[model samples]
Target: MTKAQIRQTYDRIAHWYDLIEAIPEFLGVKILRRELLQRASGKVLEVAAGTGKNLRYYPKTCQITAADMSSAMLEIARSRADGLGLDITFLIMDAEALGLHDQSFDTVVSSLTLCTFPDPVAAILEMARVCRSNGRILLVEHGRSDRERLGRWQDRRAERHAARVGCHWNREPLKIVLKAGLKVIDARRAFFGIFHLIEAMS
Candidate 1:
């Protein structure tokens, strides 16, 4: 999907996205966010920080800058931050092209977002570029399952899923992470190998 398409799709879903995702089938995702996000510290930048779902997982001492392209989505994220009394700076920016200075953050994060980025490679490169030397890059993403049956299910529904949710269900997150040249520190899979949790260094 084009950036405009993604923006519009997210804008339309902003009001109900969280509610929809909170269904029983996805409740485990909240736990995944907490576990994946605990690795973050110091100055942090989060790309495609949707609805601030990960806001509560940050350490109190960490400074956070959350960026998302959709204005409507950012509004909910801002509200979530405010409600949590978390001092977070929210930016309306694209992940593929960030406006921030180089090596500005100690850690960079992107969660459940890589698949939606129009240029996942470019976005990963941008994440690596703004991270300080040896800084951590943490990502909690979902992708094609290693299990054949589930993989086939994802393959069949990938395009339709993208059309409805702005997410590419079949893209492997590690491929783009490596393609961007970030050094992997730790990597694992869970939820039947569909969810990828990664910790890397820039």
Candidate 2:
């Protein structure tokens, strides 16, 4: 999908996105979120922070700035941050071409977003660009399953799935991260290799 189309898709689903994701969150995504976010420190920036789902998982000491292309999604995120009583900076921005200064954030984060980005590599590169040289880039993303049967299933339906939500679920998260030229410190996969937890440095 085009970037505008993707934004419109998220804007239209912003209200029900969380509701639809609740079951998966309960099963294991929530734990993964917590695990990935716990490592964040100092000034943090969360890209494509849909509905602020990760807001509560961040360390209270870290100042957070959440950015998303969909204004409607960001509105819901703001409410979540407010409910959590956290002072967070929110912005309507493009992940592939961030407006923030380079090396400004101590930790950069993104979750379940690589699949939806129009240019996943460019977006990952932007994360590295804005992140401090000494800081970490943490990602928790879903992708093609390692299980051949399931991976084939995902491959067959990937286009149809993306039509519904702009998520290319079969894309390889780790490869895209590597293509962005960041030095990967660690990488792990779960849920039949569909979920990737990655740590990297610029």
Best-matching candidate per lDDT? 2
**Tens-digit per-residue lDDT, 5-116, candidate 1:** 9999899999998887685227466677888788899999999997888899988889999999999999999999989989889999989999999999999999888889
Please list all clashing residue pairs in model 2, or write none if there are none: none
Q: What alpha-carbon RMSD in Å does predicted model 2 have with respect to the real structure?
A: 0.9
Q: How many steric clashes between backbone atoms does each model show?
A: 0, 0
RMSD (Å) per prediction: 1.3, 0.9
Q: Report the C-alpha lDDT of model 2 over 90-202, residue by residue, as the tens digit.
A: 99999999999999999999999999898999999999999999899999989999899999999999999998878899999999988989899989988788888999998
Q: Cα lDDT of model 2 overall?
A: 0.93
User: What's model 1's overall lDDT?
Assistant: 0.89
Native-structure RMSD, model 1:
1.3
Candidate 2 positional error at 53, Å: 0.4
For model 2, how many clashes? 0
Candidate 2 error regions (>4 Å): none
lDDT of 2 at 96: 97
